[model samples]
Target chain A: MSGREEILGRVREALSVPSHAGVKAVSGEGVRDVRKARGFLPDGGATPEARLKKFRKLAAKLKAEVEVLPDLAAAGAFLADLAKTEGWRQIASHRNDLTNSVLTSLKVPILWTDDEPGTADLEQVEAGVTSCEALIAQTGSVFVTGKGCGGRALSVLPPHHVVIATLDQLLPDMLAAFDLLRERYGDNPPSFVSFITGASRTGDIERILVLGAHGPKRLTILIVGN
Target chain B: MTSDTPAHQFQEDSAVSTADFEHRQWMQDALHGYENTRGGTEAMFGDFEQARQTAAAIKWEAIENLDTLLGEFADKLEARGTRVFWAGNGKEAVDYILGVCKEHGAKNIIKSKCMTTEEIHLNPALEAAGMQVVESDLGEYIVQLREEPPFHFVFPAMHLKRDRISQIFEEKLGTEPSSDPEELTMIARRVMRQKYCEADIGISGANFAVADSGMISITENEGNARLTTSLPKVHIAVLGIEKVVPKLEDLSVMLQMLGTAGTGQWLTAYNSMIGGPRQPGEVDGPEEFHVVLLDNHRTKLLADPEQRDALRCIRCGACLNVCPIFKNIGGHNYGTTYQGPIGSVITPHLRGLQSYKHLSFSSSLCGACSETCPVKIDLHHHLMRNRRNAVQEKGGKMERWMFGQFAKVMTHPKRYRGSEGLMRFGAKLWLPFKGRKLDPLKAWTASRDLPAPAPKSFMKQWQAQEREQEEGKS
Candidate 1:
């Protein structure tokens, strides 16, 4: 048997045992019901209007405290302007085409590198920008597959993360979004796919939401219009 | 409060603040573990309620039908040319893991953070068999250095402060004192880098095992888990039977949910899916791979419809991060391998109800854990069920008697009203000595003020209000 066949055959045999009782075949669509099966309502309220209202309310409540940009271009400009204003020393982006494109367009003076971000560079770099695979419109989430986007650390470690996502990347719901992902790539997909809604925020100590506890503090989403 | 005082004996270990080097050192270590785990967990759960439901449902689906999927998984694993071992309990699991280590002549073994191994206490057994086991995960490494059990699942060193870590590293490895987190991380990486290279075997926990390809998936940011499995000659994974999913497509939904719920991320830095070792043209990976499927009270848990959903936990740590009780007291306060809402519910199931009788009541039942769980385990309700089971069925004789008496009085209003005056008489007699040496109220009086009893209870006031309303109408 071929290598793929051999591996898949093992998976089939392992799945064949009487012990694998819960091993029901669920399609990409069934995965949506799995999320609903858990009885999870999206972050805001149930209705789309309510969810939108809640998102807006939450954004407004935290807007003054947590930074929000109008769009991806404005976000990029804000980050660029912030870099200049703050005298940021370095900038980093994943080796993906879109991020490289953004870096080319922005044409900032900061030393831009598209290599794997290490701890030392992450500390020195003032900003990190990357193109995202998917964005959840409801909660302002951004998804990045690890292969092209310099993996998880590039977005997580840097203090300021500016994600450039296209309009078509936006998903109406998380269940629908995940379904789309599975439909595109089967079980053995990429090594990593990250969904980042906002910057690293923690309320662990006395329930006071502290940004940059372990990951990036400021996350600016740049929704690139098609 | 009574139990809290013992925890305060290690008061210096609390990770709430960096106040003084002595106390703050402990707090930083604790906070480090808390932050590490919470960061990862929140990233995975994204939204607590959504993640919790998804996790709970997925887990229930996995376990309720375990008999079929596990068999399929076993078959798939064997077809991949990997060895599969079914361990009925902790002893069997430990025996199989140690046996694998011994068979490989594994003098050194590097491990990622696998709680099931901890549940089975595999390390000591491996050690007893004369093999050195090194935890490659940074947080687990710190806890190993401190000679303490893991406080948090994801971030094991959460209970230790940075200064304490500096002191440990300084003592063990002759490193200098530094409280900076980056410096601490570098220090750990520098040490673990060596351990990873020389180890003969790699051991890890599976986040999800894809039945489609017999692939064991592990999610991590540090890349240590990858190194542990990939670089070693022999790789062994210790997983609960419930970790298996039927296909790779199913694994995607889990990865997305696990990523968000565990650390509030869309995905982790490393979502490694390895099927049995290196193939024909592979450059690197283990030569031999074995997965020890541990039952260890899981079958019993699976039998119960109410408790079976707890198995769906991706171990994302989101529930622990959002749990108010866990935040204040930390994971050790629960006194089990699992901690927080899920821990409070699962510990008794795995260890049985006798030793961990007090673990269930530790939660305030605020449902924060349930609200935050990525798989939606209904943690709060399960916690309540654990408490009810404890009182009605488990041995809480005194508690049951007190509640039974209280219930009797509550149900019979006449008897309750008649006893109210007598209760007041006792209160009046006890008041003069309050806050003094002669005070009967020791614990309550020392911590907070006991409000003076109302002259008339709400029931009496309500009755008077009703009479006034009737008079006015007439």
Candidate 2:
């Protein structure tokens, strides 16, 4: 017998349950009910304003910069000023409409990572900016799917990452974020989904916090008020 | 490294580790830091007890229907173009990986930190096949350089000083010696970044496998797992069969509990869920994705109803951090891929009771491990059961005989009084050789001073006081 067959058989015998039990048990439930069953809301009040405030506070604690801009134009201006201050010559970004507008306003040399740039090209870019699927307030996490981020390397390879998102993307907690994902994607989800809480970090060496370990060292979030 | 049996080796290994002053100090400092921050992070969960119960229920339901859940997971993954392989043991798992490597003509492999791989002993086999394998996690990298097993579960190089790490980097990588941790992290990062780009195969272990979505969730503080998966053309994830969860939504509870309980983080820096190979429009990620579900004695563990709860572990390493015995002896003393309370309960079942029964006896029967467990597995009770089973199997003749004698004397007052007289006489005879090595007292007084026995029994003293009161009243 194949290893798969043997393993499944052993599992069935060990648990003393027949095959296809789980499928039978879960057929009646809808995704909404499943979401409600394990709905875990963070301690902060569940409102857009409250979530945004909590997100800013938690993001700051994680050493990430957060700016709540008035509009897309203000976000663009903020990015432009940030680029000048941080001395970034070129910024890599995806082909999203919002990302395009911000990059166009900055007037800096742009590397379109949507075209799948090489590792050497990605290394040369000082920073990368992209829009996210959702921003979790409780943990200060940005949810990025493979389709939304163009590719994983754009967010990981650059030394600095600047995310441009609107207030509508904020969720109360991880459960709400997963609910949003299920509502949007249905059964056919993206190949890769990541909940990036902060810039890359490690405390492996004598338990000392060090940032920028094989990923971005600095993360700046531009939250445009919708 | 010792020729002694596992039972004897455990005593010797623990003795050596317990006496190492520097190692003990390092463990104390690390555990204190963990204790200070863990409570605050766990408090962020808001109704953490409810969350724990929810997590436990999800795991229990999934394990009860593991056959169906695993089948659903495999089907969904295969439908998404992921190849699923099931291995009954470590050899089968290793053969499948080597076969894949040979098929692709791969020369170099990079791996993220995974305890399952360590359980299977995968590295030496890959190196024996003439492939250059590198461990991407900084902690794992340090221990890899030293050719030693991880000193702790989460903190692989927890026993080493910063200067020792600097020296290892200088000798191995020919880099400048620096004691700064930030510089040390960057040095390892600089070296590993090139390896990520150059490697042909990338491997990882899943923190959780979502059955409904057929996705593998990997949580890490470093971005190495992310880089390891995205850079290579072929990505392989080796997971234990018990890592499965029934629904994708259940991930929220497990992830929250895991982050807080493991490293005292509200959430880890990165939590990645990979469903299959890169989609058509995606520019990065592996071209081929493989998921190997390994049983490796897990089915045997599941068959016993009393011990099946051991499979609910999320590999958070919290129990190890809070365990008093683990703090004293350190991680490497366990002489296994897994260490501490959870390791003690499950290792005997995974490996066998005969070889690993001593691990069950090594504990102080402290319930600290169970109290700290996010899933509430009744770990201390499981250790007691192991002891019961071990004695039942091995038949401890000497212990039984001694306990029988004590029970006989305690049950009868006449014999008990007779023994009290004998003990008073024996105490005087053995008082001179208290510090010397002797049969019964040797083990007790090896490092301690035994208190002298009372001159008279407690019962006799009570009777004397009663007689004095009666005479005074008359």
Candidate 3:
């Protein structure tokens, strides 16, 4: 017998579950609806202003720099200032629409990668910039999909990562983030989706907190008010 | 690796572990740090009990429908171009991975932190097949360099001091000796960065497998898992069949519970949900994705209704952190890949009751483990059940005889009163030699002094008080 058949047979025998047991197929909408009705997700903040406040506070606590800007132009200006202060000669960025618009106004040298970035290209770059899919307020996590900057490499390979997001993308919690994902992607989701809480960190060595382990050391989120 | 000989070795292992004062001191400090951070986690989730209960229900629903859910997950993953392999045991799983390596002519491999791989001893097998395997997790790498098993679940090298780690790095990697953890971490990062880019195959263990989307979610504080999957030409995920949830929505609750219960974080630094290989437009990811579903002895645990809840473990190590015996004895004493309360309950069934039954009796039965369990598994009760089953299977001749005599005397009031006097007389005779090795009381007296019995039995004192009360009334 095939290993799959044998294993499945064993599972049925072990659980004493009938072979014809009717397992309900859960749809994306059904999951969202049920989770919404359950109300188990913790409340981040009641108002958008309250959420923004909580987001900024929690993001800072995780050691991520949070700057709330009035518009994309303001965000561009902040990035330009940050680049000058950090002495970044070139920044690796995804060639997405939002990133293009933001970089067009900034005078920083932008290195755009439309394909898989070579290790040399990623290692040489000082910073990476990407537009996030959503921002979770409760955990201060920025949700990025495979379609974001350089797929997964740009967000992790560089020493510095800057996420440019609009205020409207902020959600109360992970559950709401999933709800928005289902609403946007339907059945065909990206190959990779990451919820980056902070810059790369490791407490593996005697539980000492050290940043910049394989991923960006500094995570800066520039939130533009809609 | 097997529990057959562990019952006899447990005493020696525990003695060695406890005798190391330096290790014990390090463990105490680490435990304190974990508890302090855990307090912050509890505050982050205001109603942790409600969250735990909801998480438990989700696990229960998923496990009950394991057959259907696993089938659906396999089908969906196959549809997404991920080759799903079902392995009946660890050997089968290892052989299949080796076969894949040969097919691709892969030589070097990089692996993330995976307890399942440790449980199956996967690395040595791969190495024996002429492959160089590098462990990327900082703690795992330290233990790997020392040629030792993980001392703790989450903190693999919790027993080692920073100075010792410095020595290991100096010896193994020929780096300058440094006691600073940050410097040590940077040294490892420098070494492992090349391995990730050079590896032919990357392997990982799934934290949760969303059956609805056929995606594997891996949570880690470091980005090693992300690099392990993204850089390799072929990515293989070895998962125990039990690590499946029914839907993606369930992940929201599971991740919350796991983050708090495991490392006391609101969310780990990275939570990646990976599906198949690179998609049509994706620029980076594995060209080939393979999922190995392992069912080594898990089916046996699933068959038993009384102990099946043991499979509900997400391996958060919360129980180990809270266990008093584990704190004193340490994880290596358990002599199993999985250790502490959950290990004691499942080791007998996974390895065999005859050899591992002693672990069930090793606990203090304080019920702290059950209370701290995120899934609300009745862990202590399961240990008790193992003890009962062990005794029923093979009655202990001395224990049965002694308990039988006590039962006879306790049922008869006159015999009990007579024995009470005899016990007082016996204690007076035996108390002098209690400190001697040959004395029967040697085990009990070695660590503590025996408390002196009351001058008079409670029954006689109670009767005398009643008589005095009656005389005073008259």
Candidate 4:
């Protein structure tokens, strides 16, 4: 028999034996609904304004730079100013509805992710700017997918991750985020989905927090709304 | 002092680590920060205890129905062009992984931090086959350089200070020594960047496998796992069969619970899920994806309804951190891929009862591990059960005979009174040896003093008092 069959056979054999001690199992024997998590999980607030407030507080606590601009034009101006201040010569981004319009007039060399840019090219770029699926308010996470966010490497390879998300994209918690993903993608979800909470960090050395361990050091979220 | 015999090694390493007060201080200080953060994070939950119940219920649901979930999980991966392999044991897992590397003609491979891979001891096998393997996690890389297993699960090099890390970096990579944590991290980051770009295959361990969606989820504070999955042309995820969850939505609770328990964070910086290789519309990812489902004695664990709850562990390392025995003897002393309460309970089942049973005794029976368990695993009681099972399987003739002898002596009133003198005489003999190994009760007397047998039997004093009272009344 194949290894799969043999292993499954063993599993079947194992579960077949009755408990000698008559130990009881969980209340529901199979497929416990994850939706039962509503009571105990950390709340993400009921109102959008409340969620945004929580997001801003958490994002700041995690040391990610969050800016709520009035409009996309303002967001672009803010990002362009950030680029000039940080002395960015080259930028990496994908041509999506949000990022394309945001990067249109920004003066910098561009490494478009849609072009299948080389690793060396992405590495040399100052920052990776991609649009996200949603922003998680409770955990202050930015949700991205391989198909939606210029593949996986764009958000990961560059030293600075710049996410330009609209205010309407903010979701209350991970539960809602997962629901949105299911409703949108159905059975065929993106091969890679991530909940990027903050700038990449590690406390490996003497319990000291060090950002940009392998991915972006600075995570800048530009939440644009009129 | 490390020995081929695991039981002896446990003793030798415990003696060595406990004596190093300076090193123990480092471990204590590191865990202190973890305690504060974990306490603060737990308070943020609306009902942390209720959440644990939900977490436990979900895990129970998963493990009890293992065959169906594992089959469904595998089917989901295969449907998306991911070749799924079932490995019965460590050798099979190693063989399949090496075979994949050969098929892909892989030269350099980058690996994320994973205990399952550690359990199988994969790196040595890969190196022996002339493949270069690099550990991408900062803590893991430091331990790899020092040629040591991780000091702790979550913080792999938790026992080391920055000075030691810089020394290793300087010697191994010929980089200048710097005491700054950021500088040390930057050095590793620079080195790993090249490794990620050049590697042909990326191997990872999953925190959970979503059976409903057919995806493997990985959680990490650093993005090294991210690059490992994203950059390489071939990606292989090796995980135990028990990692399955019924659906993707389950991670909504699992991830947060794991984060609060493991490192006391709201969530680790990266919680990524991969269901397939690069999809048709995707621009860049590994062309081929492989998921290796390793049973390696887990099915043996699942079959026992009494101990099956131990399989619900999410590898958060919370139990180890809070365990007093683990705090003292340390991770290396356990001499297993996993350490502390969960390790003690499950190692015997995974390896064997007779040989590894000593681990079950290396606990204070404090139940702190059980109290703190996010999934509410009854860890301390499980340890006691391991001990019971060991004694049952391999009958302890000497211990059984001695207990029988004591039972006989206590039952007869004449013998019980006469044994008082015998016990006092026996104490005199045992007093001289004190804590020496020759003393049969050295385990009790090693660090404490047993008071000299009370000067007079309490029975004689009580009899005298009763006679005096009767004479005065008359």
Please state what fraction of the native interface contacts candidate 1 reproduces. Answer: 0.03
Candidate 4 CAPRI-style tier: medium
lDDT tens digits by residue: candidate 1, B1-474: 233533343233432332335544444445445446545445423355444444454565665556667777777677756888877778987887777777878898889889999999888888888888888776677778778888788757656656777888899889988867666666766676567667889899988877655677787755567556756778888998779766554554577567666655444545556666555433235678888887777656555556666777778887887776666667665657887778878877887765565666666888877766666566787777777787667565797689889999889989899778877888899888888887888656965799667878889999999999999999
- Residue pairs in collision within model 2: none
lDDT of 1: 0.63
Q: What is the lDDT of residue A158 in candidate 2?
A: 84
True contacts kept of each: 0.03, 0.63, 0.58, 0.85
List the candidate 4 regions with Cα displacement exceeding 4 Å.
A19-32, B1-4, B430-446, B462-474
lDDT of each: 0.63, 0.86, 0.84, 0.90
- Model 2 scores a C-alpha lDDT of 0.86
Cα-based TM-score, every candidate: 0.66, 0.95, 0.93, 0.96
TM-score of chain B for predicted candidate 2: 0.97
Give lDDT: candidate 3, residue B384: 92
Rank order (by DockQ, best first): 4, 2, 3, 1
| Deviation from native of the Cα of residue A115 in model 2, angstroms | 1.2
Q: Is the docking of candidate 2 incorrect, acceptable, medium or high quality?
A: acceptable
Q: What is the lDDT of residue B52 in candidate 3?
A: 72
- Candidate that beats the other on DockQ, 1 or 4, i.e. the better one: 4
Candidate 1 structure quality by residue, lDDT tens digits, A38-111: 23333424564454444344334322122334555565575667667867767777555666555654645443
